[model samples]
Target: MRIVLWSTAIVVLVVLVGVVYEQVGRYRAARDFPAPGKMVDIGGRKIQLDCRGSGSPTVVFEAGLSVDGSLSWSAVQSKVAAHTRACSYSRAGLMWSDASDAPYSARQVAQDLHEALTRAGEHGPFVLVGQSLGGLYATSFTKYFGAEVAGLVLVDPSHPDQVARVAAFMTETRSLRSRIAVWLAWSGLLRAAAPSLLPQAPNQTARDSQAVHAFAPKSMVTQLVESDATDASLAEAGAFRNLGNRPLVVLTSMAPYTEAELRGMKITPEQGKQVQAIWEKLHEDMATWSSRSTHRLLPNAGHDIQFDDPAAVIDAVMSVVETVRADRDNGSH
Candidate 1:
């Protein structure tokens, strides 16, 4: 009986210590890494918007799920900014942005972005570049604000049917893993493992990403919430099929899942191949959405094509931008 009581007390003490550590870490992170962009107030909440360069038809970047917010596009943003205005933002409750009590959905995210850009005095007829799940949000954005979108660049974008199609071969473990990650982040345990867990890039952006991964516990919660709403988000994105004659570029990464990755998912090599085929097919179909669309595949790049090959992303964006500009010039004449 005494041992049990002592064990309970020790557990309580450890939890208290952990909570304190997490709070302290959060405070320091806030102080050290302030929002590197404008925090545009959308009524009661503020979203971080980072814009650089100057031009018409601004290029906006949308990051993937479980990413380091705007920092996910760090490699490509500056290069694109050189040609025209390039902007990237953190979704609500990620990085330097405030949290939202509203349910997470692609529509909600799109609405938030629209409002943020408007409030920030950033006008549209914008070129949107979406990576992974961001692709879904971009599609939703076009559905709601079609007039404002000039073109789209999808970098290994997620398809609405990917979840259902892949489920036949591999069980969905990401949802469970994301939940565990949220708990780890909340308990401050994630801080210790974050450096090793996140991608190791040798640059200032990588350091900033590591800082966010270590300190932003709420971002983990946001990621989990978004994951839970995947069905609804997919449904919303699925509603939009055609982009008329708008310039579109679908960049598909053809790299196979690593042996370790396949093992972790409990998927055999054969199942992995099947899943890959489905992915490629979906991306190919996405290219057909527009009469003027290009589908490019990278043999060596992985899912995170922006990091694997920023040049590909940059070229795609530039191509779309040039197309939009030429159209505008022709119309003026």
Candidate 2:
């Protein structure tokens, strides 16, 4: 009787405490997150831009999925901004960019970005740098917004059509299983029992998300996670569903995990070969994609080439800058 009541009260108290903790964690995650930098009104939408540096053939970085604005472009933005007015922006509904009723497609994003560049008085043939999902946007710019682009550097770019051909093997095996495992690990029961600890070192000294964006390069894993550009229920399908014609540099992840990654993904060797062959074809298509497209491999790069290898990205953009300068000079004649 008395003992049962005490135990019941204790259980209720524990549940209440857990609820409070979970809410606190969520609130912190939301609050600690920083708004993107420098809002520019482009085509009636509030777009965030980090436009630093100076000079022409302005180097622009289009971020991978989920990331927008300064944080999205951190890795390569500053390095390029040092030499030219490099622009990195948050797409609509991402980070600090205005949420739109519009679908998140390559074309729509490109149009919005076009407006931003125009509003900033940025002119055509700018060097484009994009990683993962951003590759779709960059490629679309070449096909649809050719007037503004000069050349492109695709850092581990994603292709719309070949996606099914790309990760299908992994999806068929370990990836799905790992995803399920993570789901279980982060489930309500586990989260309730999990210790209250900060993701980084726990001092309650919350990291300055803004400073992280204002400074430092993006993380390779974060970049990799930004691969899905669309919010579609189907996952892989998104706007700018194809890479029509864009100068590209496809940096592949050589992290050594295979179809036997962690889940049920048991991709066959033939499947691995197929994925490689698809990339080779994408490389070959680059010639058709641009008048002068280069495919350079980053030996130790992951999906987020910019984040993992900023110097390589810097080198690529510098190369484009040189070309843009030469072309402008030649055109002036």
Candidate 3:
């Protein structure tokens, strides 16, 4: 009995040590890397906004759900910055940004972004680039501050109806997955193995990847709140109508899913086709939101068109910027 207790204690001690080591690693990574850009205060909390290049109108990039906003756009931003002033920012509770209060609804998230840009002195009229879930927030921003927006680019954006539609399809499976992910993240197990779990670039060294992974965990509290608020966020964003003929470019990816992805997401080929049909329809509707809108589909790219083919995104953004600038130059818009 005593031997068993001693063994159990040893195992517990090892596990506890591992947890502490991971927590410390994460803390150190965040402290050492520092925010690439200055943290602008949005009320009590702070948001990190990384801006590059010079020339207007300023272009702002918003990331997909649960992604490192600034890092995700590192490659694209650098390229776009060469031609025009481009900025990418972490929403509250993401990356180097501090956590904000509850109810991260679409409207609130948009407000947070507007406030961040204003506080950072990033003057507009601005061109906005949004990816995946970032699409909702981007649209909401335009709705609230339409006059400030000059152009829009959406990269394989998530339709506001997606969460509800997908939820109805795989509620239980998604709920289970979300629970497991959140629990693991909260327990620090995810952070402990983050180096392996996080994405690595072809040119990035292992240490660079580790540093990025260490600081990228989305806090479970924030994740849970965001998940719970999804429907409301969609509803709020859906209320907005018309884009005032803003120059809009929607880039879509038509990459076929691999067997692994299909199985992992619990989607069959038929369901995938159905989803794609709905997705394309939504994109078509979004194009109609503006008279000066175009939708392009890339057969080879995946959902992350920015990463899969940064050139495509860059081209689309530059096109929109040029159009907007021309309008401004001619005093037409």
Q: lDDT per model, in order? A: 0.86, 0.59, 0.79
Candidate No. with top lDDT: 1
Off by over 4 Å in 1: 175-178, 201-204
Q: All candidates' TM-scores?
A: 0.95, 0.68, 0.90
Error of 3 at 322 (Å): 0.4
In what order do the candidates fall by lDDT, top score first?
1, 3, 2
* Candidate achieving higher lDDT, 2 or 3: 3
lDDT of 2 by residue, 195-299 (tens): 331122211123333333221122212322333334331233234334334344555555433454333335666666566567657645543455466777655
Tell me the alpha-carbon RMSD of every candidate.
Answer: 1.9, 6.7, 2.5
Q: Model 2 segments beyond 4 Å from truth?
A: 1-36, 167-255, 258-274
Better of 1 and 2 by lDDT: 1
- Clash numbers, per candidate: 0, 13, 0
Candidate 1's residue-wise lDDT over 1-333, tens digit each?
999999999999988888888888888888888787799999899999999999978999999996488888888999999989999999998888898888788888999999999998899879999999999889889999999998999999999888887888877666666568677775677665566666564333656776666555767778777877888888889989888888999999988888977987789988888888899999999999888999999988888899888899999999999999999999931
Error of 1 at 148 (Å): 0.6
State the displacement of the C-alpha of residue 178, model 3, in Å, after optimal TM-score superposition.
Answer: 4.7
State the lDDT of candidate 3 residue by residue for 1-333, as single tens digits. 999999999988877876787678667877777887789988788999988889999999988765455676766888899999999987777777888865578878788889998998889989999988787789889988888999899899877676666653443334665567656664566676555546676433465455567665664436556767777777888887578789999988888866866776688888777777777888888788889999998887878787788889999999999999999999998
Candidates 2 and 3: which is better by TM-score? 3
TM-score of structure candidate 1: 0.95
Rate residue 44 of model 1 by lDDT.
97
What's the lDDT of the predicted structure labeled candidate 1? 0.86
